[model samples]
Each structure stands twice: as C-alpha cells, then as structure tokens.
Target chain A: MTDPKRPRDPDPLADDAFDAALGARLRAGREDTATLSAAVLSRLAQDPRQTPPGRWLTPAPMAAGFAGLMTVAGVAGYLWVPLFGAGGEDAILAAALGGLVPGGF
Target chain B: MTAEARAKGASEAMDALMRGDRLALSRLIALYGPGIRAFAAHQLGDASEAEDIAQEVFLRVWSEARRYDPARGAVSTWIWRIAANLCTDRRRRRAVRRFLGLEAVPEAALPDDAMPGAERIVAGREQMRQLGPALAALPDRQREALLMRTAGELATAEIAAAMGLSPGAVEQLLVRARAGLRRTMGEKDDD
Candidate 1:
C-alpha cells in the first residue's frame, strides 16, 4: 500500500544515464569507422571455420557407434579366442573359467 | 542446404563440434560471433569491455559445450549465462579497484559544476552514483530477473527456462522487481 504517484524511493536506475553515457562513448568512438572493429573481429576469426580439437563432434552418433563397436569387440574377444595355457595343466577349464571356480587337479 | 536445411546443417555442425570436429567450433563462432558481440555490447554497457567479454564467453562456451545438457537449460541460455557471468566478473573487478582506494572518482561525477561538458556528465554521474547503491542493494534474483526480462526480450516462459524458474515464479519475480525498481527510483514522487 505505497503511494503510486510519489517518488518510490529515489530511482535505482536513475543513473541508467551513466551506463547510457558509457555506451554512448563506446559507440561514438566506433562511429568514425567500423573498419578497425571489423578487422579486430576478423582477426579473432582467423580460422573462420576451423573447429578446434576435443570438441563434441555434432555427428554424435558416430562417437556413440564407435563406443558400441568397442563394447561388441570386447565381448567377441571374450567368447571366440582360445586364450589358454599351452602347457595343459588343466588350462582349458582355467582359461574358460578366467580365475573363477578352481579346476580340480 | 535450404534455409531449414541450413539450420539442420548447423545442427549437424554442432554435432560435429561435439564429435571433436575442430573446425566446427570455428565455424560456429564465425556464424554467431557478430551477433553475440552486438548483444554483448549492449549487455556489458561498453564495447571495449564487451569485445573482450564476448571473446571470453565464446571461448568458454567452446570449451564447455560438451557439458551442455538439454534437461538443465537451453543452449542459448547456457551461452547467455557465460556472457552474463563475464560481465559480472568485470563489474566485481572494478568494484575491487574502487574498494582499494585505487579507483579514482572521475571529476565529472563530482558535485562542482565548473564546466559545461563536465556539468552534463556530472548530473549523469551523480544520478548513477546515487542509484548504484540502491540497485546493488536489490536481491540478486530481482535484479537479474529484471535484466532477463529486458535484455533478452524473452517471454516469461523463455525466462523461466533460462533461469530455471517456473513461469509463474518468473512473472511474480518480474512484478516484484519492477515494483522494487519503482520504489527505489522514487517513481512515486517527483522534485
């Protein structure tokens, strides 16, 4: 229930003019020529379309697909390979078991 | 690519960026930097600082785009926050300078009106100096709520998305922020 017509407090943004002035000064300097600013921008864009490395590649499905492939490859290697001791001291069961369920000697 | 296709192409480009496509990042900047700079100019309130801040924001965006989560916020809002954060940091640095007594008050902001140009700037300066504390005193959410409302020209829904507030909450925040500003500025009274 405050007075709608009275000066509410003192205008917190009354100094918006100061920010406006700062904006004005900055723009005034640019008014003479846009060439320098343009050049500066161009310098920043020296490699206009060159993407830097380690960025997320938008074709994200490829990265996902690659991950899937790695997973499959690992499982296949586990299932298909004959990774066992040539000197058969109960090696077949041992390799198949992979350090699990000790083979009876 | 047609216009829609071009945008789709850009979406793919962003994906490529996500895929570690080094050039996509640069392409994205080339496409969006100017617009970002223009917005930054207005948002930061000065071009000299705006340019540097814009560059810093974009670099941070590039470095962190991978962390962007749609569930958390819109990509645009994420970028906006980077820019806003940089501006706020600059403000903090300036405040620190002023705090150490190293910040000299510009003569134009002083009370004495000796010269015409100085006199003009003085009024503006004095008004701002007076207003600064009040503006600073406002709740951060209220102040940022106002900035979000004005700067982005965003609808309440969009503001809600960017700020992670409910739309209703955003509207209420805006109401309070405006009322707060009005109260602080003495809009209820005049000299």
Candidate 2:
C-alpha cells in the first residue's frame, strides 16, 4: 500500500514519455562534431585574439610608453603659455630651458 | 569516471585552457560538443546554424575562460549558459533582420538522399514536423527553460541560473511549458 502522506508523483508516465521522445528527437539532430571542432580550431588558430597572453604584452608596454610621452607633451604645451607669459619665441625657449634647469629662472 | 572526477577534470581542463592549452580545449570540445550541438539544433531548427552556434560557444569559452569561477557553478553550467545566450542572441538578430526587411537566407533543406537507412533521422524529422510549430509557439523563456531541462539535461537550479530566473520562477515556467506543449500536442492533461 502507498503511504497516505506521501506526495503524489504527478504525470509521471506522461512526463517521462514526452521527455524521452523529445530527448531522442533532439539526439537525432546531432551533427558531426569532428568537422565542427576542426573548423572551430582552425578559426581559433587564425584569430589573433587567441594568441598567447604575452603576445599582447609586447605592444601594450609600447602603447603605454607612447601614451605617457603624449601626456607629458600635452602638459608641457598647457604650461607653455602660463610659464612663458605668451610673449615671443625667446620667452618660450627661456621658459622651457628654465623649467628644465632647477632654480634657473 | 564519477561525477566528482569529471567535474574535477573539467575544472582542471578549464584552468589549462586559461593557460593556453589547446589539448585541454580539445578535451572540452570532446566532452561538451554534442550537448551544445543538440541544444542549438533543437532551438534553431537548422543543423548548420546549430554547428555554427556550437563553434561560437566554444570559442567564447576559450576566450573567456579566465572569467570562469568554479565557486559560482559547474563548468558545464557556465558553458551551457553561454550556449543559451548565443542561441537567444541569434534568434533576436534573425527577428530584427526580418523586421528590417533584410531577407535572411532560408536554411537549406536537409538532403533526404544522403542517408536512406537512418531510421532515427526519418523518425526525428517526422516528429519535429509535428512538434516544431507547438514548440515554437511557446514563449521564449518557457521554451528555453523547457529545452534546457529536457534537451540540455540541466537541473532546475542550473536552468534558473542560465535563464537568470529564481528557482521558483523556473519551476513555474517549466510547468507552464509542459502544459502548453501538451495542450498544443493534443495530449490529455490528466495531472
């Protein structure tokens, strides 16, 4: 005899049958993985993104250096007018040289 | 291998993949390729597209292996989530293309002449012919939950995570999906 307090298994047979049929049909839809995997690996090999991690590091430091140089140049250009008093080429040159040499001004 | 052993192996394989090990990726493909393909095939209704989706899923896996956290879930769950999202994105793109009057090329018809003795293929095509419309008629979330449950063989909790739903919501979606499928298929709702 089944336990009275136990929860009933609802739609047991029907659910199982439906799921089994569905799973079987889906399995039948399977494709050839070897060819697919080969294609995927080939694409991966060609993709530069998949290159070794440090392969990107080589360009990264160079990019950083270039960015740093640009930032310094930008700061210098911003301070050029203020320091040189917006006068002539001689003042600009003097300001630049003064900034480079400590207490030269 | 036991489930524990398999999980450990998968985790190790993922670590190796993150470290740029191609053999580990090959192992992963051998392990999870069929499940991904089947899920994509059922969801998209096109074998070639399914193959493409499967490959894309693995490529994403290879690219994003560093982001995988075993503490969050199993590796299979992570991979299936990627597959599910890719399938959803493809469907959405197709819909948008249709809306924009960009005529998407129709999937090529399967060549019936290729395999005369493949009884499973014959039977599956017939079943899909009868069932495809009903399956497609389901709401996207319900259909995804149902397919991940039935075809992907994922547990409810895993489905919830993949669908970004609470477990309770996932159960409700699944129940509604089953009822909808049964009603459309003309099955008696005895339960």
Candidate 3:
C-alpha cells in the first residue's frame, strides 16, 4: 500500500501547496450545496420511493419477448408466402382489390 | 464536524432511511449532497448536470436502500460511488450527443454563465481560470481519483473501492493528476 505520508514525486516543481490549495478550493464548493440539499429533499418529498423492481425486467425476459415477437413474425411470413407468393393469383388480386371492393377478390 | 462524527451521522442516517423514515433522507442529503455536487461539477465541468447527478444519487439511495451493505463499506463510500458513476454516465452521454451533433463540444474552460454564483466567483479568479480546463484535460481515471479525494472527501481506500482500483493505483493517479494539472496550468500561463 502507498503510504499517504511518503512523497511520491522527486520533481522540485511539484507544488504540494498548490495541490492542497486546489483541494481546499474544491472543498470550498461544499458550502454552497444547501440549495442542492434542499432541492434533493424537495424532490424526494415529491417523488415517493417505490419497491425495487425485481428481475422482471432482466435480459432473460427481454430475450423471451423478442423470441415471441420473432415467432409471430415468422408465422405471419409463412402464412403470407402461401397466400401472396408469385403463384397465388387469387391472393394477389384480392390484395390489389380488397381495399376498393366490398368483398375480397 | 470531525470525519468520524460525519461518518457516524451518515451511518445513522442510512439506518434510519432503511427503516422507512423518509425524513432521514434529508439528513443523508444534507451530509453527502455537497461533496457529490462538488465532485460532479468539477468532473463534468457543468453545474446544471452536476445538480442533476446529485439529485439522482440521492434518489437512488432512497429507492435502493436495501442494496446498501454496511459490511462492504461506509455509507459515504456507497454514496460517493453512486455520484461518481452518475458523473461518468453523464459524461459518456455528453460525448455521444457531441458525436451525433445533438450537443456541442464542451469548451476547454468551464462555463461561467451556467455556474452557480459562488462557483462563478471562484472561476473568475485569474489563477483559477485555467484550473478547470486543465482539470478537464486530465485522463478520466486521474480526474476521477483527484475529484473523489478533493471534492468528494473520499480517502484513497474509499476512492479505490468506488473506482475499483488498488489503493496504490489511486495514489499514483493522484500524483499524476496533480502533475498533469500543474503542467497544463503552466502552459496556459506561458501562452
């Protein structure tokens, strides 16, 4: 473990004072955070916490949903090919005229 | 307050929060909010985004109280980890927005206009003028380590836990970060 007291830099230009001053400046920013704290608390009051979501939204469920969707699309495509493929004259006519005609062609 | 007192308070607040005392959330916020905001502002160079990250961090604490494992680390460490992760995520989103032309590239210097009144005064100082961009220019890990130490009040070991780095690595990063900032600020002076 690196000892916090040990000087790691041999460079004469390394200004430990400057770094400490910078750290102080950074810490100085802390005083102005009352507005932030109030804002957070106000937001907390506005939005009540809900129970944590279980594994319902995990990748496994998402993947299963995708598989279900793909299965649906595949079944649709399989049925669609038999009706609307190049050999299905009636299917093509019906698709072309179905919207315009009261009954499908 | 002393560090020990602050840690004890934070621990008590976390326990209260876990016990469904919503008011304890305010105490936790009062304790950790400033450090998280400071760390986020310095790391992202955007005050508005820093506020958002700070708010989100507390919200997560409220909603995810069950996830807190005291055996692993202190409440401060856990909260700092949340803040750091949110800042990292926000920075990544900013980069993606820039890449997609939805957001402009951030200026090297900090945005004084968007900064809070006090931060503006600090940024307005002549010597401190270049510090922001010099800080922004440091390597991401180095900047994160330094900000956690300075702004987040995280010890080397706490930073290591938050950042998933060894304590030695965190110390090296701090050393290099200060060196890099000095060089960059010096160059700005030369120019």
Candidate 4:
C-alpha cells in the first residue's frame, strides 16, 4: 500500500544542508577504529541463523530417517538373533515370511 | 543484487522476509538497525539503553516482517518507523519512573560504542561528551527532528511519514534543526 504522504523533495540548498547536518550526526555516532563496536554488532548478530548447536539428535530430517532405519534393523535383529533359540535361516525365513512365501510346492 | 540486483534482490528479499526467511530478516535488520540505534541512543542519552531498544526493535521487526510491503516504502523506512515508535514508548516509561522519584538515573550517559569491536569507541564517546552540552542546548523539537532525520538518513518524505507532519512542516523543521545544530556547535557563517 502507498504511504500517500511521502515528502516532496526539498530545494537543492536545503537538501545539501540537511545532508551535511545528518552526516555530522552519523559520523558522530561512529566510535573508535578497526574492531571498535563490540557491543552493538555482537548484539545484532545474536540471531539463530543456522546450524544451531545443542539439543535434538540431528536435524529433523536426518533424525526421522535414522529412526526408520533403526526400527527395521531392530526387527531384523529380533528375528535373526535367536529369539527362544530359533536361530539361523529358519529364523531368517520366519522374519521374511511377510513376502515370497512361494505358493504350493 | 547491486542496483542491478536491488530491484530483483529487494523483491526477492521482500518475499523472503514475508516467508520468514531468517537471512532476509537479518539483512533487513542490518539495513536499518544502526539508524534505529542512533535514534535510540540520542533519545535516551545512553548507549546501553539504546542497545536495549535496538534489540527490541529488531525483535518486533522479526515478528512483524511478514506484514511489510515493499510498495509502501523501502523496508528501511518501515523498520525505522517501528524503532522510532518503540523509542518513544520507552521515553514515556522513563518519564514515569522519574516522576515517582524512584528511578535512579545512570551517573554518565552510556557511550555509542555499542557496535561490535573495540576500535574507535573511545574517540566516539569523547565526541559525544564534547557535543553533549551542545546537543542538550537545542530546543527539543529541533533537536529531535534533526537527529531523527540525519541519524536515520531518512528522506524528508519518510521523515514526514514517521513524524506525522506535513512535508512542508518537515522541511521547516529540518531547516530549523540544521540552524539550531550549527548554533549549538558554536558555528556562524558570514552570509
């Protein structure tokens, strides 16, 4: 939306003088040299931009993928790792029973 | 985007800000942050208070950035208006504290060296101290109008919009602000 009240440009001399006054104020706002302003800039840069350290096991995407893989691995481990002493390929077949049941022999 | 990029860049940045892009928000903060800080610092006569106000201003920007529309004014102007409003609010609160005879004012005004690094803050503070008397001597309206205009680098139009005055009034205020500033600094021209 338009502001509907933007100022008309000032006359040339007025504009120049205005600029000069402002320049002084801005320059005056400047402090020391080189690494002068630790206070304000430090404060300004304190936003959470990216790669936030601490908390959560991973970025949410990776964590979700990891959880899925871990679940599948846990199921495979349970089937193959001799539950009730049902070791070896028998256990493997039982674990794989969801598919490839190979009809009538 | 340079000027070459500013149009495309600003448009994209505007969209990014609306979409809550953190980087865009940071850019917007940087664009107008210093001006806001300066205005706050000058208004409160203390850098610590100014920094506090600056952070508040940015937080408000982060929250309200989605509402900003580039067609109205540059993001810079829009943000400064927010900052100015916040500073004015704080000034009111300060007045209340002072009235209660309970607010213990700081011994010396904080220096504007609130920016990062330790470079020239001392010199800057010295200048502020040297100019403090001069700055205090001006009529309130002239001082505020000059500081708000120059420190923010606001064009007269944006200044008018922020101050709620006619552009003609702004021009008059600005002219008086400059003359007052020159007189405050003990400068005189033959012409």
Could you estimate the TM-score for every candidate? 0.44, 0.69, 0.73, 0.60
Q: Is candidate 1 or candidate 3 better by DockQ?
A: 3
Q: What's the CA RMSD for each of the models?
A: 12.6, 9.8, 7.6, 17.0
DockQ of each: 0.03, 0.20, 0.28, 0.08
Q: Cα RMSD (Å) between model 4 and the true structure? A: 17.0
Q: Locate the minimum summed-lDDT window of 10 residues in model 3 chain B.
A: B106-115
- Candidate 4 residues lying further than 4 Å off, grouped into runs, are A1-18, A21-105, B1-12, B107-122, B187-191
In model 2, what is the error at residue B71, expressed in angstroms? 1.4
lDDT of 1 by residue, B100-162 (tens): 988653321112122248656566456645544444456766656555544333456756776
lDDT ranking, best first: 3, 2, 4, 1
Worst-scoring 10-residue span by lDDT in model 2 chain A: A51-60
**Tens-place lDDT digits, model 1, residues A12-91:** 36434433443332222222223323443454467534443323332364689799999999997666554543445456
For candidate 4, write residues B1-191 as lDDT tens digits. 13334344545666786786656655544455566666777777767787677766666665566677777876656666777676666777677878998787753344554545676676656666655555556666566676666666667777777777778988788777666666666552322
State which candidate, 3 or 4, has the greater DockQ.
3
In terms of TM-score, the best-performing candidate is 3
Of 2 and 3, the candidate ahead on DockQ is 3
Under CAPRI classification, how is model 4 graded?
incorrect
The whole-model lDDT of each prediction reads 0.54, 0.74, 0.75, 0.62
